[model samples]
Target chain A: MDIPRHWRLRKQRYGLVGEVCESCNAKVFPPRDICPECGKEAKTLYTFSGHGEVYSYTTVFDAPAGFDETAPYTVAMIKLDEGPLVTAQLTDLENRKVEIGMPVEMVTRKLRNATDERGLLVYGYKFRPVMN
Target chain B: MTEKIELLKPQRPVGIVGYGAYVPRYRLPAKEISRIWTEGQGGLPVTEKSVPGPDEDVATMSIEAARNALKRAGIHAHQLRAVWVGSESHPYAVKPTSTIVAEAIGAVPNTQAADWEFACKAGTEAMVAAMGMVGSKMADYTLAIGMDTAQGRPGDPLEYTAAAGGAAFIIGPAENSVAEIEASYSFVTDTPDFFRRAYQKYPEHGHRFTGEPAYFKHITAAGETMLKATGTTPEDYAYAVFHQPNAKFPQNVASALGFTREQIKTGLLVPMIGNTYSGAAIIGLTAILDVAKPGDKILMVSYGSGAGSDAMVLKVTELIDERRDKAITTIAYVERRTEIDYAEYVRMRGKLTMK
Candidate 1:
């Protein structure tokens, strides 16, 4: 990933910041300016509570480039408490099985190592089993 | 006339308004480490050590802890005037971990950010600076974090104990504090006990030299100084915590300082979580605060290689009980763990590079 591109998405990547539509009262993730519900401009920033449950999940044995080191990792579609489904990698699994409705919480983590040894480290949010 | 070196106190009394600790969920048991290297024949230093997942690092863990601190402090991130991270294993060599933390917590733009290093005591160094900032009223609140994903040579003695985890404390005025800082003392000297040159993958210690002349000397001096200057004895403190590189070091040090096992038990977590380096002492303090009652006096001491110690006396306030449950407790992080084998540990720690 390029530095500027990653930098641009920092708010979303770091804090789960997204848009909330006033017209339809919908929460939009990935922060699209236009609301999917009302087709209106939904630019008000809202930080997710980072609490969610696994809507669906898959364990990736064959990892993508820049992620081979962490192969056999699980990626899940999380249904946020606020009614948005976001795709993220589930971490801190500790060998436990991931169920469809397991509760999880957001945590900041290294998304991947730098593009190269001299490149920048990419960090983002991942979900883990909630402690409580 | 003789010069006097007195314990340092904030002008207006500053204390930990909120505090949080993070221990990675993964555990690499000592026997697992021994199984690989020592054929499971050696006496282990600790029962287990916390291991950062492939994705976790100092910056990420620090952010988690800081968020917890913010949540417990009941304040907006923007209200923070500074964010200082103390660590030896900052993911980036040149970039500042403090900025990443500040930005993640939404404290950027208006926050003074920097990183501090003093070996293991790096966290308390930041804590001392935070005291100064909040004490002088230069900042209403400041965040100081001590976190690390410390590494050791593949088969070195340090490997068994070098671990991942840390704690964050929000320093503010006494009125809002959960624990009021009464006084602090620092003892430092030029000593070459441990070093990891720039770009080095693992740190090298001076074998037994790390003890006696380094950890013991500095910690004892700072501990005794803080006690004498405050006109308090070890018996006065309800609890005491020390920088724990392993279970033995803190136990030994506590005994030497006149603190009994009962006084040190609540804060001695290294046996279960390994040595979190910069996070060692502060995380222990967090654990102590987890169950401490109002009016409970606590003593804390942290030692860093190359070499120094920071000691402080804190008195738990009425706010402790009300605020402590606001965030995850240290014991919860400790219990919410899973055991990993040596092979998984190597994979998570990135000890084996993929071509």
Candidate 2:
């Protein structure tokens, strides 16, 4: 939530900009410097295509601290088209209607508020169902 | 030569190369808002309005609409020379919404970006500037957008009508355009029909004053001026789109200007989605463009409550049919909606206070 932390993670927060393993052709999100698949250093930065499908999901009935305003939200694990499974909250859909394999696309959104403390707004990526 | 209207004709013929609109899927019925207050006596003036999710704002909506515009333009985002966003509800107070949009659309590093404000007509204001930039050969393509996740103070009349949505247009030469701009004109006056001072969360308006002397006066003046300047009559236009603050104003204004119900009905969305503030007129224009055939002409007038109106004459081209299907149309967005009750609407819009 501090300035440095926010600045350092911008690439990952925006566009899901990460790294793809050159040696093993594996995709890593929130990108890792060292590829887990081949134990080699990631040399190339890959921006995600942002098209994906819901792989798994659960409705959070119990609100977490600082998230009481948006309780009972559905969070999902999305399998990106480029081969990375990302955990994100499902947006613009009914909690009861969230199903596995629903098509979605990434969008920038306000993640949380630091209103009580530093008055900082944490913005990042969230996924919404792709409109026809 | 004597001129009656100061028509804005870019140095060269500029037209809409591409266009797109985005209305969030979530809808909040006016009755739901009225339900929360419980003290209001009458039925809701508008049926329902679109609401932005907790994560969404003008910046996010503009990015989505701009992406759609780029898709229809069939050009790389890098090829865009300018990105302009006009909105009253820009997310950050100090930061420029255009920069965020420009970076999101990949038009950064060399493109011009700015945020504009003229109330509801802000989007059209940006469009006229974009046309000038492209027509002057200063840029090959310019992206202009009007978007807002507008806010309405609780228990206020504006709350039932202020809504969320956006539309984007790519301006370029007429040679590759889908809708050619024949001519445009602007009218302004020292009318204080609606306004929001600095740091005010919601806007204020002069109840009856916003009607005849503000919305009607500006819209009629600009509408008549554009028509006369273009040497066209109301009968010559296939459709006319007026800035819709609510369902009643556009209908009344259009009728007073000699346009029939059928002529304005196609672009009348305020009854369904409330007023998107800056996005109101441009989104309506996008709807008309979706159904209009090649060679159809449209009269569009946008009113902002400072107040002023920007009027334009546009002629559709054969290229419209080819590009219309390339992206999702306005009707699709309007139809793909889900209704939410007052509680959910409040939560989604982040109206609740958190500790």
Per TM-score, the best of the predicted structures is 1
Question: In candidate 2, which residue pairs clash?
Answer: none
Model 2's DockQ? 0.44
**In order, how many clashes per candidate?**
0, 0
* The best candidate in terms of DockQ: 1
Docking class of 2: acceptable
lDDT of 1 by residue, B287-332 (tens): 9999999999999999999999999999999999899999999999
Decoy 2 TM-score against native: 0.92
Instruction: Encode model 2's per-residue lDDT on B1-355: one tens digit a residue.
Output: 9765669998889999999998987888888877778654677768899988766778878988897888788887778898999999988778798987786666767988999998888899999999899989999899999998887888888888999897999999988999998788999998998888988878888988999999999999999888777878899989999999888889989888899999998888888998998999999999999999999999999999898999989999999988988888988988777898888876677667754
Cα distance off (Å), candidate 1, residue A88? 0.8
- The C-alpha stretches of model 1 lying farther than 4 A from their native spots are A113-116
Ten-residue region with minimum lDDT total, candidate 2 chain B: B346-355
The true-versus-predicted C-alpha distance at residue B180 of model 2, in Å, is: 1.7
Task: Give the worst 10-residue stretch by lDDT in candidate 1 chain B.
Answer: B346-355
